[model samples]
Target: MMKGLYCLQNAIKWYEDRFCVRFTPTVIYALYPKEEEYGWPQPWPNPDSAGIYIFLDSNKTIVYIGKASQMGARLDHYFGYGENGKCILKDKRVDDISYVQCYSCSQEEPYACLSLEEYLISEMNPKYNKTGRTEW
Candidate 1:
């Protein structure tokens, strides 16, 4: 029994890595949109900016998080075509979307939005964020 259990654990880990399960926290936030009334020019006062996004399941669980230089454009991808020309909306698992806009302090900074996004993901430990081992 011990040997079988060990094998199973290893198999699961292998599958996870193979599927790129160890995703950065920002990836989770990039999949969803923030509540309305946040207003246009998102993360306002800083137009033409970058930020992180999140995708939620029907139960309001965070399934994915991601960072993007152009939050609006990245969001379009989630609502429309996926990498393989597949429609994400057709996927029954995705129920809602939201985002938090994080503007960059300077033009040279990279992944600035991602930093805050990662912190939030680690703290929240949302249900759909399978990449992190923490329990919410």
Candidate 2:
């Protein structure tokens, strides 16, 4: 699992170089919002932060890779509400979600982090990615 994270970070950087989407790899651990922590509509951590996230099966296999400018909002969409986000939610294989923030990417440059997301999808070839694995 730790090795996967390291490769993920490198893939992100490689994607950035290929697409000119520069951003700092300030990896931060993101957690799911717990009902006990902040009540019904729990909101404790910075929801507006941007980052890269992944879903793993119980055996720690990479199931999906995603990214968003607002980490909380993105997580909520999948774990809480959002039709499109249901892709991960509906998948029984996924048991965990983890994230690493694109700490220095500014709001104005959303594309900067997208490259990282793309890299992870391509390199990892996660099951849930719509595009699947690229042949080249």
Candidate 3:
């Protein structure tokens, strides 16, 4: 778990080194139910906001990375949904959830968000991202 979390921390560090912009995650958590004892992101901001999610597995290894138009709703679909849910998290049970609530000053932020997805896919090289999964 520490190793995987370190990788994410390293990813942030690398991003900072290259862009000189320190990244701040809006939420960092283990994948527990919203009503669980551990809890979800407290003081959860903007339930309908655009964001990216970094999903970790039981071993705390990063397994999948994806984006959501609405963070709260989408996460609910996966983590807080049914026993046989059809969402991405159906097959793989995530153990941890880290998020970056995204925004942009430029008009092309959506495109940039896509690029961030690509960049993270490349950098993180998660196992479950079968489509266009890139490696270091």
- The C-alpha lDDT values of all candidates are 0.43, 0.55, 0.52
Candidate 1 wrong stretches, greater than 4 Å = 1-47, 56-63, 80-91, 98-106, 132-136
CA shift of 49, model 2, Å: 2.7
Per-residue lDDT over 1-136 for candidate 1, one digit per residue giving the tens place of the 0 to 100 score:
0122233235334533554333222222333335643322323223344655554554334445566786556655545555755335544564554433233333454455555456545544555453344222
Query: Candidate 2: minimum summed lDDT over ten consecutive residues — where?
Result: 33-42
Considering only N, C-alpha and C atoms within 3 Å, which residue pairs clash in candidate 2?
A: none
Distance from true location, Cα of 36 in model 2, Å: 17
Which residue ranges in model 2 land beyond 4 Å of their true spot? 1-3, 17-46, 58-60, 80-104, 132-136
TM-score of each: 0.42, 0.55, 0.58
- State the displacement of the C-alpha of residue 80, model 1, in Å, after optimal TM-score superposition: 4.2
Q: Which numbered prediction scores highest in TM-score against the true structure?
A: 3
Please give the RMSD to the true structure for each candidate, in Å: 13.3, 6.8, 5.9
The predicted structure with the larger TM-score, 2 or 3, is 3
What 10-residue stretch in candidate 3 is worst by lDDT?
99-108
The best candidate in terms of lDDT = 2
